[model samples]
Target: MPRPLRSENLQGTLDLLVLKTLAARGALHGYAISTHIQQVSDDFLRVEEGSLYPALHRIEGLGWISSEWSTSSTNRRVKLYSLTAAGRRQLEIEQKRWDELTLAVKKVLECYG
Candidate 1:
Protein backbone atom coordinates (compact mmCIF):
# COMPACT_ATOMS: atom_id res chain seq x y z
CA MET A 1 0.00 0.00 0.00
CA PRO A 2 1.08 3.55 -0.56
CA ARG A 3 2.30 5.58 2.36
CA PRO A 4 -0.22 7.84 4.01
CA LEU A 5 -0.33 11.38 2.68
CA ARG A 6 0.97 14.03 5.02
CA SER A 7 -0.31 17.60 5.23
CA GLU A 8 3.02 18.94 4.00
CA ASN A 9 2.30 17.22 0.69
CA LEU A 10 -1.02 19.07 0.44
CA GLN A 11 0.30 22.56 0.89
CA GLY A 12 -1.44 24.19 -2.08
CA THR A 13 -4.68 22.24 -1.98
CA LEU A 14 -5.80 22.39 1.64
CA ASP A 15 -7.86 25.49 1.08
CA LEU A 16 -9.60 23.88 -1.87
CA LEU A 17 -10.47 20.80 0.13
CA VAL A 18 -11.63 22.84 3.10
CA LEU A 19 -13.78 25.05 0.89
CA LYS A 20 -15.31 22.11 -0.93
CA THR A 21 -15.97 20.30 2.32
CA LEU A 22 -17.83 23.26 3.77
CA ALA A 23 -19.68 23.80 0.52
CA ALA A 24 -21.02 20.26 0.54
CA ARG A 25 -21.55 19.77 4.27
CA GLY A 26 -22.55 23.22 5.46
CA ALA A 27 -20.94 24.49 8.64
CA LEU A 28 -18.38 22.20 10.30
CA HIS A 29 -15.76 22.53 13.00
CA GLY A 30 -12.03 22.14 12.41
CA TYR A 31 -11.92 18.54 13.59
CA ALA A 32 -14.95 17.60 11.54
CA ILE A 33 -13.43 19.15 8.48
CA SER A 34 -10.21 17.28 9.07
CA THR A 35 -12.12 14.04 9.58
CA HIS A 36 -14.08 14.52 6.40
CA ILE A 37 -10.94 14.97 4.35
CA GLN A 38 -9.27 11.90 5.80
CA GLN A 39 -12.33 9.67 5.50
CA VAL A 40 -13.29 10.72 2.03
CA SER A 41 -9.79 10.08 0.78
CA ASP A 42 -10.11 6.56 2.17
CA ASP A 43 -7.48 7.23 4.84
CA PHE A 44 -4.89 8.14 2.28
CA LEU A 45 -4.75 11.73 3.44
CA ARG A 46 -4.32 12.69 7.06
CA VAL A 47 -4.67 16.32 8.01
CA GLU A 48 -3.06 17.17 11.31
CA GLU A 49 -4.38 19.84 13.68
CA GLY A 50 -1.22 21.91 13.31
CA SER A 51 -1.84 22.46 9.62
CA LEU A 52 -5.63 22.50 9.68
CA TYR A 53 -6.10 25.28 12.21
CA PRO A 54 -3.69 27.66 10.54
CA ALA A 55 -5.31 27.04 7.18
CA LEU A 56 -8.70 27.74 8.70
CA HIS A 57 -7.56 31.08 10.05
CA ARG A 58 -5.85 31.98 6.79
CA ILE A 59 -8.84 31.08 4.65
CA GLU A 60 -11.14 33.07 6.92
CA GLY A 61 -8.93 36.12 6.62
CA LEU A 62 -9.17 35.84 2.84
CA GLY A 63 -12.94 36.39 3.18
CA TRP A 64 -13.64 33.10 1.44
CA ILE A 65 -14.86 31.59 4.69
CA SER A 66 -16.27 32.62 8.05
CA SER A 67 -16.36 31.03 11.45
CA GLU A 68 -18.15 31.26 14.77
CA TRP A 69 -17.73 29.66 18.15
CA SER A 70 -20.32 26.97 18.80
CA THR A 71 -20.93 24.09 21.14
CA SER A 72 -20.37 20.65 19.73
CA SER A 73 -22.64 17.67 20.24
CA THR A 74 -20.39 16.49 23.05
CA ASN A 75 -20.99 19.79 24.86
CA ARG A 76 -17.55 21.01 24.01
CA ARG A 77 -16.90 24.37 22.44
CA VAL A 78 -15.63 24.45 18.86
CA LYS A 79 -15.21 26.91 16.06
CA LEU A 80 -17.63 26.22 13.23
CA TYR A 81 -16.53 27.18 9.74
CA SER A 82 -18.72 27.80 6.74
CA LEU A 83 -18.05 28.84 3.19
CA THR A 84 -19.03 32.32 2.12
CA ALA A 85 -20.45 33.41 -1.22
CA ALA A 86 -16.98 34.41 -2.29
CA GLY A 87 -15.72 31.00 -1.31
CA ARG A 88 -18.24 29.26 -3.54
CA ARG A 89 -17.01 31.29 -6.46
CA GLN A 90 -13.42 30.60 -5.53
CA LEU A 91 -14.23 26.89 -5.32
CA GLU A 92 -15.12 26.86 -8.98
CA ILE A 93 -11.81 28.43 -9.86
CA GLU A 94 -9.90 26.05 -7.67
CA GLN A 95 -11.69 23.03 -9.09
CA LYS A 96 -10.76 24.05 -12.61
CA ARG A 97 -7.14 24.48 -11.68
CA TRP A 98 -7.11 21.12 -9.91
CA ASP A 99 -8.61 19.43 -12.92
CA GLU A 100 -6.00 20.91 -15.19
CA LEU A 101 -3.18 19.93 -12.88
CA THR A 102 -4.39 16.34 -12.63
CA LEU A 103 -4.83 16.06 -16.33
CA ALA A 104 -1.30 17.22 -16.93
CA VAL A 105 0.04 14.78 -14.39
CA LYS A 106 -1.97 11.95 -15.90
CA LYS A 107 -0.59 12.70 -19.33
CA VAL A 108 2.98 12.62 -18.09
CA LEU A 109 2.50 9.34 -16.22
CA GLU A 110 0.77 7.73 -19.17
CA CYS A 111 3.63 8.69 -21.50
CA TYR A 112 6.56 7.72 -19.25
CA GLY A 113 5.27 4.85 -17.18
Candidate 2:
Protein backbone atom coordinates (compact mmCIF):
# COMPACT_ATOMS: atom_id res chain seq x y z
CA MET A 1 0.00 0.00 0.00
CA PRO A 2 1.10 3.57 -0.59
CA ARG A 3 2.09 5.64 2.39
CA PRO A 4 -0.46 8.12 3.61
CA LEU A 5 0.19 11.68 2.51
CA ARG A 6 1.13 13.92 5.39
CA SER A 7 0.65 17.69 5.11
CA GLU A 8 4.05 18.25 6.64
CA ASN A 9 5.64 16.08 3.97
CA LEU A 10 3.97 18.23 1.29
CA GLN A 11 4.45 21.72 2.74
CA GLY A 12 5.80 24.11 0.11
CA THR A 13 5.93 21.56 -2.68
CA LEU A 14 2.19 21.07 -3.01
CA ASP A 15 1.50 24.59 -4.17
CA LEU A 16 4.29 24.36 -6.71
CA LEU A 17 3.09 21.09 -8.15
CA VAL A 18 -0.52 22.22 -8.19
CA LEU A 19 0.31 25.43 -9.96
CA LYS A 20 2.52 23.70 -12.49
CA THR A 21 -0.13 21.12 -13.23
CA LEU A 22 -2.78 23.70 -13.89
CA ALA A 23 -0.41 25.63 -16.06
CA ALA A 24 0.66 22.60 -18.03
CA ARG A 25 -2.46 20.48 -18.20
CA GLY A 26 -5.10 23.21 -18.29
CA ALA A 27 -8.21 22.93 -16.13
CA LEU A 28 -8.75 19.85 -14.01
CA HIS A 29 -10.88 18.81 -11.08
CA GLY A 30 -9.30 18.09 -7.70
CA TYR A 31 -9.26 14.33 -8.22
CA ALA A 32 -7.85 14.71 -11.71
CA ILE A 33 -5.12 16.97 -10.41
CA SER A 34 -4.12 14.43 -7.79
CA THR A 35 -4.14 11.62 -10.32
CA HIS A 36 -2.05 13.64 -12.79
CA ILE A 37 0.63 14.22 -10.21
CA GLN A 38 0.74 10.60 -9.20
CA GLN A 39 0.89 9.46 -12.81
CA VAL A 40 3.57 11.94 -13.77
CA SER A 41 5.71 10.80 -10.88
CA ASP A 42 5.25 7.19 -11.93
CA ASP A 43 3.19 6.56 -8.78
CA PHE A 44 5.98 7.71 -6.53
CA LEU A 45 3.88 10.59 -5.29
CA ARG A 46 0.42 9.98 -3.96
CA VAL A 47 -1.71 12.95 -2.96
CA GLU A 48 -4.73 12.26 -0.84
CA GLU A 49 -7.92 14.29 -1.28
CA GLY A 50 -7.64 15.56 2.26
CA SER A 51 -4.31 17.14 1.42
CA LEU A 52 -5.25 18.19 -2.12
CA TYR A 53 -8.54 19.90 -1.34
CA PRO A 54 -6.98 22.16 1.24
CA ALA A 55 -4.18 23.13 -1.12
CA LEU A 56 -6.67 23.85 -3.88
CA HIS A 57 -8.71 26.03 -1.57
CA ARG A 58 -5.64 27.78 -0.25
CA ILE A 59 -4.27 28.55 -3.70
CA GLU A 60 -7.65 29.65 -4.95
CA GLY A 61 -7.94 31.94 -1.95
CA LEU A 62 -4.61 33.41 -3.02
CA GLY A 63 -6.06 34.16 -6.51
CA TRP A 64 -3.54 31.76 -8.01
CA ILE A 65 -6.31 29.61 -9.38
CA SER A 66 -9.85 30.06 -10.53
CA SER A 67 -12.59 27.47 -10.59
CA GLU A 68 -15.99 26.83 -12.10
CA TRP A 69 -18.57 24.11 -11.86
CA SER A 70 -18.43 21.75 -14.78
CA THR A 71 -19.58 18.30 -15.74
CA SER A 72 -16.95 15.63 -16.01
CA SER A 73 -16.78 13.04 -18.77
CA THR A 74 -18.76 10.73 -16.58
CA ASN A 75 -21.54 13.34 -16.38
CA ARG A 76 -20.78 14.07 -12.78
CA ARG A 77 -20.54 17.64 -11.56
CA VAL A 78 -17.07 18.79 -10.55
CA LYS A 79 -15.33 22.03 -9.85
CA LEU A 80 -12.63 22.42 -12.44
CA TYR A 81 -9.61 24.52 -11.60
CA SER A 82 -7.32 26.48 -13.86
CA LEU A 83 -4.21 28.55 -13.42
CA THR A 84 -4.40 32.30 -13.44
CA ALA A 85 -1.75 34.69 -14.69
CA ALA A 86 -0.53 35.11 -11.15
CA GLY A 87 -0.34 31.33 -10.82
CA ARG A 88 1.81 31.03 -13.91
CA ARG A 89 4.21 33.59 -12.49
CA GLN A 90 4.23 31.82 -9.16
CA LEU A 91 5.00 28.52 -10.86
CA GLU A 92 8.06 30.02 -12.53
CA ILE A 93 9.34 31.33 -9.21
CA GLU A 94 8.68 28.05 -7.44
CA GLN A 95 10.42 26.08 -10.19
CA LYS A 96 13.48 28.24 -9.81
CA ARG A 97 13.55 27.80 -6.05
CA TRP A 98 13.11 24.04 -6.41
CA ASP A 99 15.97 23.88 -8.87
CA GLU A 100 18.21 25.84 -6.52
CA LEU A 101 17.37 23.68 -3.53
CA THR A 102 17.94 20.44 -5.42
CA LEU A 103 21.23 21.71 -6.84
CA ALA A 104 22.35 22.63 -3.36
CA VAL A 105 21.45 19.19 -2.10
CA LYS A 106 23.28 17.58 -5.00
CA LYS A 107 26.41 19.57 -4.23
CA VAL A 108 26.30 18.68 -0.56
CA LEU A 109 25.86 14.99 -1.34
CA GLU A 110 28.70 15.05 -3.86
CA CYS A 111 31.09 16.82 -1.52
CA TYR A 112 30.28 14.75 1.56
CA GLY A 113 30.39 11.44 -0.26
Candidate 3:
Protein backbone atom coordinates (compact mmCIF):
# COMPACT_ATOMS: atom_id res chain seq x y z
CA MET A 1 0.00 0.00 0.00
CA PRO A 2 1.14 3.53 -0.63
CA ARG A 3 2.05 5.69 2.30
CA PRO A 4 0.19 8.89 2.89
CA LEU A 5 1.75 12.02 1.47
CA ARG A 6 3.33 14.62 3.65
CA SER A 7 2.02 18.02 2.73
CA GLU A 8 5.46 19.56 3.01
CA ASN A 9 6.89 16.99 0.60
CA LEU A 10 3.92 17.40 -1.73
CA GLN A 11 4.21 21.18 -1.72
CA GLY A 12 7.48 21.05 -3.59
CA THR A 13 6.34 18.31 -5.96
CA LEU A 14 2.82 19.41 -6.91
CA ASP A 15 3.79 21.71 -9.76
CA LEU A 16 5.95 19.05 -11.38
CA LEU A 17 3.13 16.55 -11.15
CA VAL A 18 0.66 18.99 -12.63
CA LEU A 19 2.95 19.87 -15.48
CA LYS A 20 3.70 16.23 -16.18
CA THR A 21 0.03 15.35 -16.20
CA LEU A 22 -0.79 18.15 -18.59
CA ALA A 23 2.07 17.11 -20.82
CA ALA A 24 0.94 13.50 -20.92
CA ARG A 25 -2.81 14.06 -21.16
CA GLY A 26 -2.86 17.12 -23.41
CA ALA A 27 -5.76 18.82 -21.61
CA LEU A 28 -7.74 18.26 -18.45
CA HIS A 29 -10.20 20.18 -16.37
CA GLY A 30 -9.36 21.12 -12.80
CA TYR A 31 -11.35 18.34 -11.15
CA ALA A 32 -10.09 15.78 -13.61
CA ILE A 33 -6.54 16.82 -12.91
CA SER A 34 -7.12 16.48 -9.20
CA THR A 35 -8.69 13.09 -9.67
CA HIS A 36 -5.87 11.97 -11.92
CA ILE A 37 -3.26 12.96 -9.38
CA GLN A 38 -5.07 11.24 -6.58
CA GLN A 39 -5.57 8.11 -8.63
CA VAL A 40 -2.02 8.08 -9.86
CA SER A 41 -0.80 8.37 -6.31
CA ASP A 42 -3.12 5.53 -5.33
CA ASP A 43 -5.05 7.90 -3.08
CA PHE A 44 -1.98 8.58 -1.02
CA LEU A 45 -2.15 12.23 -1.94
CA ARG A 46 -5.17 14.40 -1.38
CA VAL A 47 -5.46 17.72 -3.18
CA GLU A 48 -7.95 20.29 -2.12
CA GLU A 49 -9.84 22.07 -4.91
CA GLY A 50 -9.11 25.45 -3.35
CA SER A 51 -5.40 24.88 -3.54
CA LEU A 52 -5.66 23.31 -6.98
CA TYR A 53 -7.54 26.29 -8.45
CA PRO A 54 -5.07 28.82 -7.15
CA ALA A 55 -2.16 26.76 -8.48
CA LEU A 56 -3.84 26.47 -11.89
CA HIS A 57 -4.44 30.21 -11.97
CA ARG A 58 -0.87 30.85 -10.96
CA ILE A 59 0.48 28.59 -13.69
CA GLU A 60 -1.81 30.27 -16.23
CA GLY A 61 -0.56 33.64 -15.11
CA LEU A 62 3.01 32.43 -15.51
CA GLY A 63 2.24 31.56 -19.15
CA TRP A 64 3.13 27.96 -18.47
CA ILE A 65 -0.47 26.84 -18.88
CA SER A 66 -3.69 27.86 -20.54
CA SER A 67 -7.35 27.07 -19.98
CA GLU A 68 -10.64 27.26 -21.83
CA TRP A 69 -14.22 26.41 -21.06
CA SER A 70 -15.26 23.07 -22.51
CA THR A 71 -17.73 20.31 -21.95
CA SER A 72 -16.51 17.50 -19.75
CA SER A 73 -17.23 13.81 -20.30
CA THR A 74 -20.31 14.32 -18.21
CA ASN A 75 -21.35 17.04 -20.65
CA ARG A 76 -20.94 19.59 -17.90
CA ARG A 77 -19.16 22.83 -18.65
CA VAL A 78 -15.69 23.08 -17.17
CA LYS A 79 -12.49 24.97 -17.72
CA LEU A 80 -9.98 22.71 -19.40
CA TYR A 81 -6.30 23.30 -18.85
CA SER A 82 -3.40 22.38 -21.08
CA LEU A 83 0.29 22.90 -21.11
CA THR A 84 1.67 25.53 -23.43
CA ALA A 85 4.87 25.16 -25.42
CA ALA A 86 6.38 27.34 -22.77
CA GLY A 87 4.98 24.99 -20.20
CA ARG A 88 6.66 22.02 -21.85
CA ARG A 89 9.95 23.88 -21.70
CA GLN A 90 9.27 24.90 -18.14
CA LEU A 91 8.50 21.30 -17.24
CA GLU A 92 11.89 20.16 -18.43
CA ILE A 93 13.59 22.83 -16.37
CA GLU A 94 11.45 22.20 -13.33
CA GLN A 95 11.91 18.45 -13.65
CA LYS A 96 15.66 18.88 -13.68
CA ARG A 97 15.47 21.02 -10.58
CA TRP A 98 13.28 18.50 -8.85
CA ASP A 99 15.69 15.68 -9.66
CA GLU A 100 18.61 17.70 -8.34
CA LEU A 101 16.77 18.60 -5.15
CA THR A 102 15.67 15.01 -4.56
CA LEU A 103 19.22 13.77 -5.10
CA ALA A 104 20.55 16.30 -2.65
CA VAL A 105 17.96 15.32 -0.09
CA LYS A 106 18.70 11.66 -0.62
CA LYS A 107 22.42 12.25 -0.17
CA VAL A 108 21.80 14.10 3.05
CA LEU A 109 19.57 11.33 4.36
CA GLU A 110 22.18 8.76 3.44
CA CYS A 111 24.84 10.67 5.33
CA TYR A 112 22.65 10.86 8.43
CA GLY A 113 21.16 7.40 8.18
TM-score leader: 1
Backbone clash count for every predicted candidate, in the order shown = 0, 0, 0
lDDT of 2 by residue, 41-87 (tens): 77767788889998899999999999999998899999999999999
Per-residue lDDT value at 62 in model 1: 95
- Each candidate's lDDT (Cα)? 0.94, 0.90, 0.87
Model 3 CA deviation exceeding 4 Å by range:
1-3, 6-9
Model 2: lDDT of residue 15: 93
- Per-residue lDDT tens digits of candidate 3, residues 1-113? 86777434578677888899999888999888888888898888877787788889999999999999988778989999999999999999999999999899999999988
lDDT of each residue in 47-69, candidate 1, tens digit only: 99999999999999999999999
How does residue 99 of candidate 2 score in lDDT? 99
Q: Against the true structure, candidate 3 has what lDDT?
A: 0.87
Ranking by TM-score: 1, 2, 3
Error of 2 at 44 (Å): 0.2
Worst ten in a row by lDDT for model 1: 1-10
User: Looking at model 2, which ten-residue stretch has the lowest summed lDDT?
Assistant: 1-10
- Winner on TM-score between 1 and 3 is 1
Q: What's the TM-score of each model vs. the native?
A: 0.96, 0.91, 0.90
